[model samples]
Every structure is written in C-alpha cells, then in structure tokens.
Target: MSRTQSIQPLIASRSAAHRAARSRIVSLVLAIACLAALVFSISGGEYSITPAKVVQILFGGGEGLENTIIWQWRMPRAAAALIFGAGLAVSGAVFQSLTRNPLGSPDIIGFSTGAYTGALLALTVAGGGFALTSFGALLGGLLTALLVYLLAWRNGTAGFRLILVGIGVSAALASFNHYLVLRAELDVAMAAAVWGAGSLNGVTWAGVIPVSIVVILALLGVLIGSKSLQMLQMGDDLASALGMRVERAKLVLVVLAVLLIAAVTALAGPIAFVALVSPQLARRLVGSGSLNLIPTALTGAFLLAFGDLLAQRLFAPIQLPVGVVTVCIGGAYLVYLLNRGTQKIRS
Candidate 1:
C-alpha cells in the first residue's frame, strides 16, 4: 500500500541477487584455485612431471613411466587430499552453522580424537587392515559424537556447552589414544604413530575410492538438508514454529557431518584444522553470514592439495605428512582467532 513498502521489496530482492552473484563468483574463483592446486600437486613432485604431461596422463596419453607416476602414485594422493579436504570443509560448515560458533569443528571437538582412538584399537587388537581400521575409526567418531551430544544436552543442546563438552572429551580421548599406542608392539606403534600424524604418504586407490564414494554421498545429504540447517540457526523454537522437527533435523545434520569427517579421518588419520578453518575463511571471503558450502569446500580442496605439495617438496628427500603442514597452519590460525577474540573483548 505504501510507496516505501513497495520500494523495500525491490531493495531486498536486489540485495539477495547481489549476494547470490557474489557467492557464484567466489565459488568459481575457489574452484579454479583448487584445480590449479591439483595440477601442481600432480605435476610438481620430486619426480617432476611437466603440467602438459600431467594433463596427457590424466586423459590417457602418457608413456609407461609417466602413466605409472601419475596414475598409480600422485593421482591417488592428490585426489585424496582434494576429496578429503572438501569433505572436511563441508563438515566444518555444518557444525559451525549448527552451533553458531566459529570454533565448532569435528577436529576441534572430540570426533577426530575418537576416530584416532578407534584406529589405534584396530591397529593394536585387530591386526589393522585398512578396511578394518577405517571401520573402527568411523565407529569411534560416531560414538564419541553421541557421548558429547548426550553430555551437552540439558533442556536442549547449546552451542557453547557442546563445544566445551567436546573439548573435554577430546582431551580424555587423546590421553587414551596415547596409552593405546604406548601399549602396542614396536612395529604396530610405529604404524599407529604415522597414522596419528595424518600423513597422505601411502594413500592408494584402494583407500581413496571408497572414501570418495562415502564423502560424495554424505555431502549430498548435507546439501539436501541445507535448508533445515539454516532454519535451525534461527533457534529451535523458531525452527519448530516453522514446521521443522528440530531434534530430528539436528540429528540428521549431525550424522551427515560426522559421516563426512569420519570417512576422511578413517582414511587420512584426522587431518586437522581444515574443517575448523575452511568454513570461517569461506564466510569471510564470500562476505556473507549464511553458510557458504561451495566456496568452503573449494577452499578446503585447495588448502589440502597445496599443503600436500608443500609436504612433498619442502624437505626434498623426506616427505612430511600432509598433516604436519596443516597443523602448523591451523595452529597459527587458531592463535590469530584467539588474539582477535581477546581484542574484541578488551574493546
């Protein structure tokens, strides 16, 4: 009825269009960056295949040695890094949105530690085949999530309470994991130690294929529930008033997020900080408050690919685990976040 009211709708529509366009643009840039990182990872190892040869190999045109290096070796590792990174980033976005907390990531909480504990158990008790270890890790992560959820639930789960409970549980799990490793035989301990470090060193197609499938499927589930996830951000009461089954929605989203991160941890041994940092970084980059899953996933893929490259190339003869690089980066990022928070409180 009013002219101002008529103009308000047009303004809001334009703002939405602007944000949508920006998100698309940011996603495209991040995707290109991820692709570039993948290419570099495939091409620039110690063996040093050229980018052109990398492309040829990817498309089925390279010679024997080149094909072996690309297909059998580098491609799997590179693919794992990219795929796992994307999954971790999406999982981070889900938890952060769920908790309305920047610090709410699977790794930061206790899920990763729980997964590690499971992997350790598999190694020590079950002879530690990859599939068995992966299963153990998945089971461990899910169980840990359940425990944390139960502990954090009062009248209902609050984000801060969940995070605090997760941190405490994570510390206890880490101690138990260390004890398990210490009690294992020498060779088994060595293997568990390497796994706990979260290296991508020996990642092969056998491992990568199964993980890729699980992550892809779980990511789809997250995408389908994205609407309910955002609505839940408006608070349980509000979301329920809007006809959502709040607890059920939270359960589904939590399970999907857990599945994504657990699959990655099962394969790569809890590669840290990607899930914690990727979503926050994506939000800042996209200039939006709502979840930016696409950009976050792309950023994660790029970070891991690039970090893997650094791991391989950094020490020349000795390749560090990809986890080492991410931990360092994540540590610095954590400090920065703390400093920023402190400054805000002081102000």
Candidate 2:
C-alpha cells in the first residue's frame, strides 16, 4: 500500500485505542459511584445508621438492632438492587445491539409486560408463592418473545417490525393483567397491585439468593457472547460473511435477555425502565459506538439504589415503590430522547 494508506491505518488504530481508554475510565467512575450509592442506601432508611457504623456492622463489629438491620434488612435490599440492575442493563445492551436500535429494550418490546401477565396469573392461581411466580413469569416472557419473533419474521426479522409487533402485544397483555387483577379477590388484588408496583421493601436473603443466582448466570452468558453481539451490530449479511452464526447467536442472545428480565421481574415486579434507560445513559457517558457493559451495569445499579433511597426518604412514613420513581425518571428521559431526535428504528 501507499504511504498515505499505511498512515491511515495507524491513525485509526490509535483512535480506537483512545476510545477504549476513555470507555474504561468511564466504567471505573461508574463502578465507584455504584459503590457509593450502595453505602448511602445502607446508611439511610428509617433508623439512619451512619456510614461508619454500617461498615462496622458489615465487618461483624456491631450487635443487636444494628446488626440485624444491616445484615437482615439493608444488605439483601442493596444486593437485590445491584444484581437486578446489572442484569437489566446487560439485557438491554444485548437487545439494543441485536436490533441496532436504542429503543429496543426488554421493557419496551413486551417482555416485561409478558412477565407481569404470568406473575399475575400465578398470584391468582398459585397463591403468590415466589417460586411459582418466577416460573410463570419466565414461561410467559419466553412465549411472548417467541410470538413476537414469529409475527415479525416475514423476510428475516426486521428491527422496526419486531418493535412494532412487540408494542402491540405488550399493550394487549397489560390490559389482560388489569382485567385479571380486577377479577381477583379483594385481598389478592391488593397484594398483586402492591407487588406489581415494584418495591424493595421486605426484601430478605431468602428471596435474594435465587434471583442473584439467575442474574449471575445470565450475566455470564452475555459476557461470553459479547464478541458475537458486537459482530451483529455490523448487520446480519456482513456478520454471516465474516463466519459468524448470525441466527444462532441472535437466538441465544434473545433468550438470555428474556430470562434476565423475567428473573428480575419475578424478584422486584418489573421495576420500570431501568432496562430501557440504563444502556442509553451508559452509551452517552462512554461516548458513541462503545458498548461498555460494565459502565451500563454500574449505571443501572446506581440508579436503582439511589432511586430506592429516595423512595424511602422522599415522603417520610409513606414510601413509594421503586418502580414509581423509575417510571417518572424514564418518562422524562423518553421525552428528552424524542425532543432530541432519537436514533431511527433500523430495518
């Protein structure tokens, strides 16, 4: 090649290196922020444990109410928020990459609604046990995802078609959930309503363990397939030409994303829009074209932990659901995205 061509490749390599460095720095900052949010969440709440005391209790230096509150109440809640947020963020990132559209999140594309539908049915029939509810949610989300794929698959699944079909299915499922709630017994309906609002209140270690395991497994799957996901961003034809198994990779990714959302929904009742907003926010923070999973995960954890803290203390003696807080934030962000001219839906 000519001298100019050789210089161009070297310059491009340097540019890529610089972008990678910037993405790493942003990820580190987000990780620190998430840790700080966790500490703040553990330290706040009704009794107002100091950060120092919280750390002390964490290390087995405290006794009585202090220990109980730290170990039993705060730790589980914080862990749930962190794990659930990370799972949702990674799931969102994968789908957005697959669709090549920022709007293609699990919550926006019908998975959350489908999971809610399943959970509502389980609550009505199975009397609201966690295991049964989770199983129901997983099955429902998987079926809904399959339905969307089938409906959108006229000439290989187009991103916009999938999104449009998903929205329609999600709306219908949401109406079904409402109707089911209405038909339920008064006490059962009330319980379903509360759970559906997605609060972290009363989260215990027993509930946290299973969900954490699922989230961890899903996250590992995402990490392992991250390279193929990146390849898919170049469009299916190009990916296939490069020897990637486009269809199989896409199927695995979609299934993993659905499972992650279902597991989190089962634990926290579809905490609204964390999946929708976290990847977008992380993308902005890390600059364009850099899919930094760590930053996205950390951004999610911080948002949920901080939102839960606000929910607890914002209106003293009357805590709001974490979902409510996230909905408000997500709604505002949606408006902002629309006003600023969002990325067009890819075909």
Candidate 3:
C-alpha cells in the first residue's frame, strides 16, 4: 500500500478518537447541567429550601419539615422528571435513528396519544387505579405502534409512511380519548383530564419507583441494541447484507422504545415533545452523526427538571403542569424545524 493510503487510515483513526472524546466531554457537561437542574428543582418550590439545606436533607442531615418536604415531595417530582425525561429522550433517539427522520418521535407519531387513550380507558371504564392504568397505557401504546407499523409496511417499512400513518392514528386516538372522557362521570372525567395534562404536582415515591425501574430496564435494552439500531439506519438491505436480523432487531428496539413511552405516560400522562426535541438537540450539541445516548438523556433530564421547577415557581401559589411548558418549548422547536424545511420523508 502507498504511504498516502497508510496515512488515510491514521487520519480516520484520529478522527474517530476525536469524536469519541468530544462525545464524552459533551456527556460530562450535560451530566453536570442535569445535576444543577436537579438541585434547583429540589430547592425552589413553594416551601423553599436553601441549596445548602437541600443538600443537607439529601444527605440525611436535615430536621423534620425540611426532611419531609425534600424527601416526600420535591425528590419524587425531580426524580420523575429526570427519569421520565431521560426515557423520552432515548426513545426519540431510537425512532429517529430507525426512521432516519428527525420528526420521527413517539409524540409526533401516535404512541403517546395511544398511551393516553389507554390510560383514559383505565380511568373511565376500569375505575383507574395506578396499576390498571399503567397496564392499559402499555397495551394502548403497543397496539398503536403495531397498527402504525403494519399500515406503513407496504413492501417494507418506510420512514415517511410510518410517520404519516402514526399521525393519522394519533388523531384518531385523540378523538377516541376525548369521547371516552366526555362519556365518563363528571368526577372521573375531571380526574382523567388532570392526568391527561401530564402534571407532576402530586408525584410520589409510589409512582416514581416503578417508573424508574421500568425505564432503567428499557434503557439498558436500548444500550445493548443501539449498535444494531445504527446499522438499520444504513438501509434494510445493507443491514441485512452485513449479517443483521433487521426485522427482529427493529422489533426489539421498537418494543423497548414503546415501553419507555408507556411507563412515562402512565405515571405522568402524555408529557409531550421531550422525545421530539432531545435527541436532535443533543446531536447538534455533540456535533455527531451518531450522538451518544448519555448526553441526550442528560439534556432531557435537565429540560424536564428545569421545566417542572419553572412550573412550580413561575406562578408561585398555583403550579402549572410540566407538560404545558414542554408543549410550549416543543411547539416552538417544531415550528423552527418546519420553517427550516426538513427533508422529505423516505419512501
């Protein structure tokens, strides 16, 4: 081989190493930012605790009221925001990778709405306990995803078709959800409406614990399957030629992503747009074609924790849902994406 060819390999190696290092640095910075957001979230609510006191309570050093407030209230809310946000972000990254479209997020399509539909059914028809609602959300999301996937698969799954089908399914599910809520008793409808708004106001350990566990497991599956997911982005033929079981891999990743979506939806209602925005934002920040998951997850956690904090303190006495803030931000981002004119969806 020529000297130039030898040098090309070295150049490629150096470039890859540089990207890896940059990804790590970005992830570290995002992690620090997430911690700062968490601290602020825990310290800034109605019964305000100082940062030092919040730290003290976190470390098992504070007295009764401080301990009760932080441990009982703030911690659970913050934890839910972080955990749920991370799950949403990772799910976004997976779909975006699979579809090769920035707009291919769960909320953008139909999974979140489907999950909401399921939760509404559990509430209106089944008397809406937490466990039943969670199961319902999971079932709804899975069913919606399956429907969209099958509808989109003409010859094979095309990214653009999947998105369009998802959008249609989401509209239909949203309509069905409203009908269910409307037909329910006044008290039940009111309760479902509150949940549908995706508030973290009354989040507790009971909700947070199960969600955290499921999210963590799903995230682990994502991490393990991430390589195959990236390969799928290269096109199905190429991925198959490279010895991947493309269909099976796609199915696994989709299931995992749906689980993340369902678990969060069950606990916090259909908090929108984190899944739509986080991965793209992280990709931009890291300047990587295949962005690392850690930075995306950390960015998501910070967005949500900070959003929840704003929700709590923005109005002081009356708290808004975190979903409201995310919708505003995500809506703005969506408009920007549209204005920039995203490439046509792949057929």
Per-candidate TM vs. native? Answer: 0.97, 0.95, 0.96
Residue 185 of model 3: what lDDT? 100
In candidate 3, which residue pairs get closer than 3 Å at backbone N, Cα or C atoms, i.e. clash? Answer: none
Best by TM-score: 1
* Cα lDDT tens digits for candidate 3, 277-311: 99989988888888478888988888888888888
Residue 282 C-alpha lDDT in model 3: 92
Question: What is each predicted model's overall lDDT from 0 to 1?
Answer: 0.89, 0.87, 0.90
115-234, model 2: which lDDT tens digit per residue?
988988999977879899999999888999999999989867778888899989999998999999999999999988988988888889999999899999999999898889888888
* Lowest lDDT 10-residue stretch of candidate 1: 44-53
lDDT of 1 by residue, 1-347 (tens): 99999999999999989999999999999888887788888897668988887877788788788888888988899999889999999999989988988899999888888888888899899989888988998999899999999999997889999999999999999999989989999999998898798989988999999999999999989988989988988888899899988888898899899889889988889899999989988888888898878888988998888898899889977889889999999999999999999999999
Candidate 2 vs candidate 3, TM-score winner: 3
The reply for model 3, stretches above 4 Å from the true place, is 342-347
* Deviation from truth (RMSD, Å), model 2: 2.2
Residue 139's lDDT in candidate 2: 88
TM-score of 2: 0.95
Scanning candidate 2 in windows of ten residues, the lowest lDDT window is 338-347
Q: Report how far residue 29 has shifted in candidate 3, in Å.
A: 1.1
